[model samples]
Target: MKKENNLDKITRKEAISKMGKYAALTAIGTFVVLNPLKAAQSSTPPDDTGGNPFD
Candidate 1:
């Protein structure tokens, strides 16, 4: 059996803080990359083909 060490353990608060930081960074990165594309795409109207409902 292996021995457990206190140094290897992480508290709940620390884990939550780390996760929050990662989530925030991911959100910011996604927004930075996609925001411009979204704005550009939004300017164009979507195709509204009133085609046959049952094709």
Candidate 2:
């Protein structure tokens, strides 16, 4: 039989943190894969900051 090592153990908080990281990556990957065109578009919003100064 093999011996268990304490160093191999992870706390619940650490596990949750790791899971969160993976979840975020998965979500981003899914978004990019499903919406490649959208993802490639510019993040900046259009110049719709209200009525024109001249108007």
Candidate 3:
């Protein structure tokens, strides 16, 4: 059997750091993509009457 080398193994800290970076990037990307839609939806004035606007 071949012995495993320490240099080839990933440490817990390194794994956690990589995961954190991916999470942060995903969050930023999601926000960027959704922010425009959110703004557009909010720009429309709300109807005071209790009726569906789409009707």
Query: What's the TM-score of each model vs. the native?
Result: 0.65, 0.58, 0.66
Q: What are the lDDT figures for the candidates, one per model? A: 0.94, 0.88, 0.94
Question: Please, what are the lDDT tens digits per residue for candidate 2 over residues 9-45?
Answer: 9999999999999999999999878796775584666
- Against the hidden true structure, what lDDT does model 2 obtain? 0.88
Worst 10 residues of 1 by lDDT: 44-53
lDDT by residue for model 3 over 11-42, one digit each (tens)?
A: 89999999999999999999999999999988
Answer with 2 or 3, whichever has the higher lDDT.
Answer: 3
How far is 13's C-alpha from truth in model 3 (Å)?
Answer: 0.4
Q: How well does candidate 2 match the true structure in TM-score terms? A: 0.58
Candidate 3, poorest ten consecutive residues by summed lDDT: 44-53
Report the Cα lDDT for candidate 1: 0.94
